[model samples]
Target chain A: MTTGVRRRMGVEERREQLIAVALELFSHRSPDEVSIDEIAGAAGISRPLVYHYFPGKRSLYEAALRKAAEDLAERFEEPREGPLGARLLRVMGRFFDFVDQHGPGFSALMRGGPAVGSSTTNALIDSVRQAAYEQILAHLGITAPSARLQLVVRSWVSLAESTALLWLDGRRVPRAELELQLVHDFAALAAVSAAYDEEMASVLRRILADEPSDGPFTDLVTRLVGLAPLPGSV
Target chain B: MTTGVRRRMGVEERREQLIAVALELFSHRSPDEVSIDEIAGAAGISRPLVYHYFPGKRSLYEAALRKAAEDLAERFEEPREGPLGARLLRVMGRFFDFVDQHGPGFSALMRGGPAVGSSTTNALIDSVRQAAYEQILAHLGITAPSARLQLVVRSWVSLAESTALLWLDGRRVPRAELELQLVHDFAALAAVSAAYDEEMASVLRRILADEPSDGPFTDLVTRLVGLAPLPGSV
Candidate 1:
């Protein structure tokens, strides 16, 4: 009915509009489930016009994926003004926001499974992961991360990723707790590495020195310390 | 040359032989790269004979995947005797052994991407994860895991999966250290939950009590405790 008086749009505007509509539809369900007619119907355009803009559904899906990948990569960005733990917590909050909002799309992107998992799609997802990695490195202020540090950072990134994917499934735990726990996870991972490598210990010390008493890292320290018995008191 | 006077195999024996040959070839490369002709040639039989055993390539691929899944699932099994950390280390050793030996096959199985990733394939992969999860819970001796414990265990499993996937890419880190770190990672993940949850804390205490001084969990505690300053000296 609304198509009776459709507003005209430029080529680029129409393309952008189509992608936005497709992204919205794909975010709610699997791309395989959504049809081009449905996409055009939602976008208030003809089905043929949808193909006029893109070769096929796969192209449109890839376009939507590219946009999602960009948005997700930016979720890792935070102002470098606070303690590392707090900064990471803020990042996790935003990261989870995206995961919560785009549950299906996030799963498809992260899983890289049957739903249009091309080499290009894999690269796009990898780009998002790489962006997050670089942003964390920037926050850590490290130009050359040691191998153990790389393992810690990379492992934490994967942990956050899988955490988001699993969280999306049932959301069994509270979002706030999961976000803070992820921050704690980062610290715990680095602390383990620090215990093994002296270079990592120095990195950890430098990061911990700037943390506030009430920061997540300090909270982790307090919690872990609670497990320890007092020297000569036990 | 051996085809001149090949030994005759029974129906069941030939079927098993074909699957073994297919698994060997698929494990070496992606299933897409290996064709029916190749499978037959590898099996020292004709392509039609390969089809006689199975309907098509997809069925054979699924059969091979099923076998691989069972083997991978068994990798998590260990005798319940040693300290938790040592037991986990042994499990990780076997896990990486599979990952290291079956590099391409493991990637295809874990990624569940283009290499014949049917729903059946995904179910098989999930079965392996469930098996690993249950095995870890059995090690913890918990029939009813709290939400937080479940999160820790599942998160550790995902962490181990991703760690192995990433490790396979470049193998930049030493295999032995990565295995130990994964054991440490399980403790680290559980320790964080124990920090927040009394139930997890008690479980951690029980596990830690059984751990020897040089065990991985004990090593994690010692390493983390070293990061702390003296109560009065500092």
Candidate 2:
């Protein structure tokens, strides 16, 4: 490509282009198996120019992973003012649809080889997962965020992750059947939450009462308690 | 080691000994990272003898994994004829307790490293998970299994796997809190199953009316129909 054409492209555009190309490459092979040379060759750019954009393959991989995560999180974050159950079903439907459309990307994230040591890929996914958890907590009208919320969140996300992978792997279960099963699963989960909320609330109260003086650990504890069944649980 | 000592140990004893030693080594490190030489060295046996029992490292790793899985499955299969919810909680509790004690084995399986291909691990876990699923189905008195059962089995196993990993990795949630949450979660799951059963039974009745001939595709269709909700309504 001409230098003028390259010069006209802003950083964001170039980054997006690089991520698009890298994602395409990584989709076909494990991230470790894909090399900078291959990526640069595929993008029709020099190795130095690729380095100029991303410090290394690790950075490039992180950027691509982050982009994919952002895409996923955006789908879940679509505004909806409805009952918690309805909203959850809508988000789950979107999630299943996203997985169907981006099977390779979803597979790579869930079953990829050892990620490039503590990169943004994990943090991005964790942040999105946490956001989803918070959404559930909010929907529950959980007054105090408790450890129960964390467990429930973890359970739901784990279920969603495994189901998506199983379906993508060509399991015989139809999507509509899977969706209805999920709806029932979440409803049951909600029922359990209702039963245990009071007990969790008592635990949160005790934890708050026993709170220590200020520090990061204390902040964490306070935040956790806030998330518990008590007011300001997080 | 004396010949007398070796002869006294039966084949079962020797096989168990080999598996026990192999689990210790494999759990601490990836299969590729732990060489046959190391396993031999640790087991106080000749490398050739270790090879005699297990053909290769891959076989050794698979044996270790299978042994761990069998141990876990056996724990779940322990006789318990209580209410379905209570039986499930007992089985799940046993699962969590096992993971708490044997975190390394569970982590290794969850990591699903290069040594164990996805298909290999999936096949291994499938039988073990299927046993638990069958138990649940039997308790629910659901005849004629469906693809939905597979999804439920997959999701439940995944929840247990992810929870154990998170707990092992030192999630701040206290152990007692975690256990309580899981019990509640399982209860919710069972409630959903009860509701789904009603929907599935209605669907099954309708499909039975058509009475398709038995064939591979018919089996697939039967499985699919069994998984879905009734056509009339929930």
Top model number, DockQ = 1
After superposing candidate 1, which stretches have Cα over 4 Å from the reference? A1-6, A228-234, B1-5, B228-234
Best by TM-score: 1
| Per-candidate alpha-carbon RMSD to the true structure | 2.9, 12.4
Supply the DockQ value of model 2.
0.16
Clashes per candidate, residues 3 or more apart or on different chains: 0, 13
DockQ for every prediction shown? 0.49, 0.16
Q: RMSD, model 1, all Cα superposed?
A: 2.9
Q: Residue by residue across A1-234, what tens digits does model 2's lDDT show?
A: 555644556888878899999977776666767889989998887899899999998889888878777777776674545444446667778888877766766676776345432435556767778777666665555656655556656667778778888888765766765665565565444334434556544433332233334321233222222221221111
Q: Which stretches of candidate 2 lie over 4 Å from their true place?
A: A1-15, A21-63, A78-82, A108-127, A134-144, A167-184, A193-234, B1-16, B25-42, B45-59, B78-82, B111-119, B138-143, B169-187, B193-234
Cα deviation at A10, candidate 2, in Å, is 7.9
lDDT of 1 at A67: 93
Chain A TM-scores in order: 0.93, 0.71
Q: Worst ten-residue run, lDDT, model 1 chain A?
A: A225-234
Clashing pairs in model 1, backbone N/Cα/C closer than 3 A: none
